[model samples]
Target: MAGRSCRNSIPVAFLVAVLFVLNPPTGVKSDSSDHRYKTNEDVPLYANKVGPFHNPSETYRYFDLPFCSPAHVKEKKEALGEVLNGDRLVVAPYNLEFLSNKDSEIVCQKKLSKEEVAQFRNAVAKDYYFQMYYDDLPLWGFLGKVDKEGKADPSEYKYYLFKHLHFEIAYNKDRVIEINARTDSNALVDITEDKEVDVDFMYSVKWKETDIPFEKRMDKFQSSSLPHHLEIHWFSIINSCVTVLLLTGFLATILMRVLKNDFVKYAHDEEAADDQEESGWKYIHGDVFRYPKYKSLLAASLGSGSQLFTLTIFIFILALVGVFYPYNRGALFTALVVVYALTSGIAGYTAASFYCQLEGTNWVRNLLLTGGLFCGPLLLTFCFLNTVAIAYSATAALPFGTIVVIFLIWALVTSPLLVLGGIAGKNSKAEFQAPCRTTKYPREIPPLPWYRGTLPQMAMAGFLPFSAIYIELYYIFASVWGHRIYTIYSILFIVFIILIIVTAFITVALTYFQLAAEDHEWWWRSFLCGGSTGLFIYGYCLYYYYARSDMSGFMQTSFFFGYMACVCYGFFLMLGTVGFRAALFFVRHIYRSIKCE
Candidate 1:
């Protein structure tokens, strides 16, 4: 026994050593900051170029920043031009002016005339900000600082930062605009006895001209990032993989050896052959698929879970293959929304099928619930967040038209898809197949020990899955809140696969233990066991907010938690579905393999 223990220890020790080597504490850290301007490539500015532009009918109108001129402050129309003959239109560039430094204080040499100054003041009064693009990056330049009360500060000076812009000509006539810029107005100044202070300013603009196709331009922007030494995710990946391997090994061992022994003993029970007395899980095979209580709710949850699962897999695959590459701002959010909308049919189908199997008659209600269960909370949260943004006059707020369009998409596209899928599912299957006949009386569950109880098992099961993704979670939070770009979709995709495997394996193990303990109720328990990971994830979000992020402001806080709630909800559905499906398969395989009367 001692020697066998030592032999087992060797593999465990080897795994630990490999993980340590792969993910050293001081391994290279990758930054997704823009590095396009760092190169020596000459970017050209064309003054003769003119392009057609138009806003999507469903999208909010984007107003450009007002540029002050001698005649008046020019407010560029959001509708620049339209695509002609399936070709993208390129716009002419703005004239450039240089600033000079005198006595360590930088000043604009070409000062605006009195008329131009008046126009500039008018532009400021109208709250117009300059909008430009550099290589598919959008740069929004603010001329003044606004207070928390949404008022522009009178005493603060405005600083301008400029960088190169890149434009992509798309085949579909969708224009690609990119701008790179950053501003810093905070610098220490010395005040003398007379209370006079000296201040300095810095500003520059770089332009790069490229005729790259719209697709390639996006690819370039997404691929562009600061120099980094190595990917540190290898450590997290290895850690998660090791965990999954161990859990899978345990599950496989039990299924093959322990369950096989039980089957053999049951098969050879000659004394009870006439009476056909069964033991263990075989005793409950008849009731295992007897349709869980709260059938509609459970079906809805499963359907939504299936939808989210499919959406997640497809999104990751697209991202991994560079479909969302070039890191356009808001691209990820847009993709998720669109994909979820398109996948509503999957949710409806699963829910209807399950509900029908459970002998439910209210198909319409089930379909509605399936669509609303997850989306309802999300929409409400978004509305509240958008309201707060509008109150603060922040750019984050979606326009009323955009909001209406989103509702229309949900109502018109997603809702119909759900109905269609539900109809198909209900018509196809009404009765679920069970391995054995369910007894009229439900089996009485035995009281479990503390460790095997629902709460304890869920709490323990959740932590392992959470541990696998906590490291990646940090990077995701940084990208969202810390104004950093996350371009490593390949790593993200791998970690996501690991997370699903971990959730499934742990759920199966916990479900088996519960069944072994004579707990016939595994439906909700299996879902909760896997879904509890979301709770742990939310806890980590709290830690990230207070300890990792420098975020402040009530609006920011509201947005963070509101969006996080939606995220956690989706995670619960996805992971819970994974757990339930795995457990269902395990139960079916085990019961079907045994001899039963």
Candidate 2:
């Protein structure tokens, strides 16, 4: 046992080392850590992407919509996370120097042809917004606006583009503290005509000193574009805590009153043992530990779930420690991809060991299933979304090179580690240790009431857990689907723990009820009971889509539903595994206490 423990520790230690080495504990940032600047030094401004106000994910390159560029345009190389976040940083035409101010400088003069005018008109009509970054601080502004002047008549509407930009840069000593991009409505140019028109782009820069420190500059952007509704966030947390307390109260009844009575009745009264066995859960002790059907699939699902659980915990920890920030491009997604690839060993070991315990022989097939269980579905969904992005010429479409790099990472790093872990697990395989002996002939299960059926039990079991965290789901959905920033990592971590506890307690209670009814098939039932929360979550997603959000059109709609499906599936696997493990522990403890012949 000592030797086996030591061997298991080796893989864990190596994983930790690799994680720290690959990704040092640095907060996500776009620029160098040094903030001091020399006088008259060039402050490079990078143009990012533009999209309609309603659809956050549907974005195009800054240069895609007829934006003026430098004569010798240079592309800024971005990190993996940045690319995944659809950030395409390119050098802008405007020239600004540190501590230098300019007045009404002409950026460029353009002759708008018929096509150019139409493109501008369409963009303005859709309420397009553009994004840019100066020294890693982001700026957003509308490309144009529609003037109705409170008139309902379509003929009374006029479209105009802002041709002048005013940049206000705040500096503290030698460091840039903050930057703001403002457009004056008086500087608007009429683009309602199709005739050839000469347009002049003008910009002015003002440098002002500020008392704010450079280190505290990010605090301004930390507040989300939308309201945080912090009181509601706390309300959700308190709601989940109350649900957990309620479930805990029920679990306490089972452990203290019900299970205690059963243990006493079986142990103290040997004379009535056989009679007692004829009635409740004690009757199914012989078959309760029977190896479930499709054990390989069950094992693989559990393995993947374990990995996801670990990944989620670690990600939140990282977020709490400031390794990931809401404004840091795609840092969270990048960490997810990298860490998941590295932790394939966990999945392999878990699946292989559990499958061996179930007396499964096809190691290779089990290994394949474990590896592809989550990644396969995610890859397919991403590919489909990428195809749509390509068709729409959106920035969300990943370049071919990035795709190849990801494939290489998986093939070279993830697959090999998974195989190694599988080999280790196979070498250290052990038999399943069930306290109750199984009879050669399977015991007959009695017919159950409609209310006691698996489907009803699953629904009942799932609803409690879902209710605990349903409120939190709104904030999560808003952050992902809208413009809100999720900065409450500590609250999220607390809610996560609550979710697991609620899922476990509810599943265990249901498993006891199922066994009490003489239904020994509790393995998958417990899992489904816990995982049914995902179904409710998906249902809520539908409600949120139709009633809560303004998201529409094919690209945004497909992207929302498709990605959400994958997310819910992950929840299913993760919570299901939690349920199964808790029920297994409960069964083993109770059965071991009672006399099982």
Candidate 3:
């Protein structure tokens, strides 16, 4: 009985080992005081409160600030924040005009006409907000009473204002644009009832005598803004590497041994010219490549999967090269949108080609399905979340004009690319090379044991893939949902490679088991087995929301889950593609090696 208990415990012990390797606990203490906000001693005190200081070296270019117009304005317009409804309204390009001169000071005050004041009132009524960038950090301006500890009280929140706009331009050797702002009694404007508000602007310039290079100052600003987690990131990567190496060694050894034995047996049988054959995967070669029943859906999945695969690879490569560094607000989102739009051609070509090979006739329908499959769900979710954000007066909500721009990008740019790719794919010949000819009727799959069934196999296959990334996922969640700054793209790239390998190996292992059980219908099973990792990831998100995060608002919750759904969908596509390709290669290699004429 003791020996029997020991044997039963072996599987549990192995599972615990894998879990430990995947999530090695960091030695750092989890004390709340460690992360509490600390007052920077270097910051200058104003009225017993410390205010943010300007880093002269870092300069940033300003973009258009989004404003919602009242029912009077025929169309909404986006403009520079400095020009909108500030104490000192200034126009674009000229807003930073001070940067052109090295040692000059000028003060100009402009009075707004009745029409302009009325427009400003209308903008305030419609909840106009400013988007300000200094260096790479986003600056948010709010009007409220400040407490003794330098904290603004939410109860005293009155209105939104862009108080002080200071531009510092240096021309020692090269031109640079630097900006910093401070709030004072004179800069505050109360717009609670949306009445006609007059605006007057005064400019004061001060030059600091310093010899620091602009690049060095910019580097200093970046370092201060973003969090530094190099040690923790390396620790997580080492753990993940160990897990991946173990999995790789185990898979390589098992596959080689099994394949070698099978090859030897088959070769010996061929030499003896035996009529009878083995009773495993060799018997199912004729039906292994049989087209699945839902060919169109399968084709669409493969196409979208391939498109996401390409997008993820390119985005990571760009990030590794520092293209989407945190210094640029919204740069990553812009890059993803542009890349996804351009890669629509790849999606179209893949879907059309696969559908054609499946004997599909409607090229137009296939093309539409391929493009809409992933984008449709994403757009719908985004629209729903945007609505919630707008209702809550959240700055994260996108304006209608921006939505139109996104629509135009999808329709004008992405649609044309998809059409071009579909035309090319439809005109090309469909060549599917199968060693054994498919039978007229589908092969009957045998009854699988409960442990080997679809759900169980998917659960087992998904756990390892999810485990490989759950540690990194925690950091990502903190970055997205908390105040953490994530800048470990190199480690992310490494973990991504590991995720692909683990998914591929596990899918191959699961496929082998299914085939050995005389179950040849693996088209969807292979995809789902590995793709289920996304389901696990979604579950973890739920856990984080309830257990780890302090989020409580309805809008925040809705937006979080809404965007997470889209994330999981992309993960499903990517991992599903990896699993399908791996299984396909496994099946083809196994059948091609056997003499099944």
TM-scores of all candidate predictions against the true structure = 0.71, 0.93, 0.70
Compose the digit string of candidate 1's lDDT tens values, residues 1-597: 999989966743543343233222111111212322223332322111111111111111122222211333333211101110011212323332111111222322333344544443434333334444333344444443322344366444342222122222222222323334444444322221122222233344443444665434444434214344124666667877787678678777876687768777877874454776666777776667667888899999999999999888766755554444432333345556566777799999999998898899998899889989998898799789777866755545665655676688688988999999999889976677566677778888777788988889989889988888898898778766643557777778888877888888888888877777778899999999888899899999899888886565577688778889899998998899889888888777777776555
lDDT of 3 by residue, 1-597 (tens): 999999976744543343233222211111121222222211110110011111111111112122221233221122211111111111222223322322222233334444544444434333333334322223333222332244376444444333344444332233222444433455644543335554444334343334665445444433313444666667778887888789778887897798788778776777875676656776787788898878888888888999999888877765665554443324455556767887889888888888898789888998999989999999899788777756754445565656776789798989999999888888778776677788878778877678988889889988988888888898888766654556678788888988999999999988987887778898899999978898899999999989887665576678678889999988998798889989988888888888875
Using lDDT as the measure, what is the rank order of every candidate, best first?
2, 3, 1
List of clashing residue pairs for candidate 3: none
Task: Output the TM-score of candidate 2.
Answer: 0.93
Sort by TM-score, top down from the best: 2, 1, 3
Error of 3 at 450 (Å): 1.4
Residue-level error in angstroms, candidate 2, position 250: 3.3
Superposed model 3: Cα runs more than 4 Å off = 1-131, 134-212, 221-228, 271-277
Best by lDDT: 2
Q: Rate the local accuracy (lDDT) of all candidates.
A: 0.61, 0.83, 0.62
- Of candidates 3 and 1, the better by lDDT: 3
**Candidate 2 deviant stretches above 4 angstroms:** 1-33, 153-156, 224-229, 273-277
Per-residue error at 64 for model 1, in Å?
13
Per-residue lDDT for 484-544 in model 2, tens only?
6777788788888888988998888888888988899998998888888888889999999
lDDT of 2 at 596: 72
